[model samples]
Target: MQLEPGAVVEGRITRVTDFGAFIQFDNGETGLVHISQIAHSFVRNIHDHVREGESIEVKVLGRDERGRLDLSIKELLEEPEEVPRPRAIGRQSPQFEAKLRSFMRDAKERTTSGAPVKKSTSTKRKK
Candidate 1:
């Protein structure tokens, strides 16, 4: 049977490589399932997902420039649900804003007056 594009069929894994796996259909037609098409997550090792002589269902993704059949296994599997990210923190509190404004005002005053910032040691208490 001719494996047309968008056709889903059963095939046997003839060989497994680092890039992808070769599948042989019942009609002797062969196709390649790339590593990215193996699963929804990253595939570090092709053997971890498929091995030689394994039977699996794949979808025909048409042919390449060289006329080689391209197949996909992940297309048949359900996509994973995306987790929503937490919302960003709200605006700063009124007290925090007040402190920030006060600090900025003091800095501007010191700069404009060309006065060096002095560290307060008057709060030091005798033991």
Candidate 2:
């Protein structure tokens, strides 16, 4: 079967290396799941996570320029929990409509001034 980018498949471990593991895709294609991508944490060896002849499910990330496939096993194994984001820096906790009104007011003031509002000058130089 033709495999599209981001597709997932099951494959058997054909080889392992310091960098990655060679896997045989079920669709007659082969892929390498990089050691760094094997899991969320650092992996010292590919053999610790995969073994020869072991069937594993991996996500088809795509092929390299030389036609070798690149696969990912991390995303295939578990779904990460959604993170709760803290308030964005420099942004006040205000409703959307209130922020919009404030922005509009500032914009109107700048436009009606008819001149570039001077930002700053040496206080001693000012009359």
Candidate 3:
């Protein structure tokens, strides 16, 4: 009946709330599945994921400072698909090396010249 961290248990949803759902394990021990741990994706409403009296399998995320069991349904679920990252156009090693050389040449010219170099401003324009 002692629930340890990383323990997977089958429980019934005793109650549901805006923040989380209360789960009562078969051993009579209870825990809370926080809204964030309810689903793999963003959960704006806990009710959308689970309902009262529903049976679910959850993983113990360990106890809190108050010794209350914290659980997660998302951890028991399968991993989500990875999103593709966007690549910068014209971003290559040769282009990077050329840019570095250009920067060094500019810096050298500024140092050799008696004129003070102007500070560069952000390229993002304010709306």
Which pairs clash in the backbone of model 3? none
Best by lDDT: 1
Q: Which 10 residues in a row give candidate 3 its minimum summed lDDT?
A: 82-91
Runs of candidate 3 exceeding 4 Å displacement: 83-127
Question: What are the candidates' C-alpha RMSDs?
Answer: 8.4, 10.2, 9.0
Residue 94 accuracy (lDDT) in model 2 = 75
Per-residue lDDT tens digits for candidate 3, residues 1-127, read 6589998989999999999999999788899999989877777778878999999999999999999999999999887796334565875799899999999999899999989878899999999
lDDT of 2 by residue, 1-127 (tens): 5566787777899988899988886667778899967987667667788888898888888888998888899877664565335455686557976989999999999989897886876667646
Flag clash pairs in model 2.
none
In order, the Cα lDDT scores of the candidates are 0.91, 0.81, 0.90
TM-score of each: 0.63, 0.58, 0.63
Residue 83 C-alpha lDDT in model 1: 32
lDDT of 3: 0.90
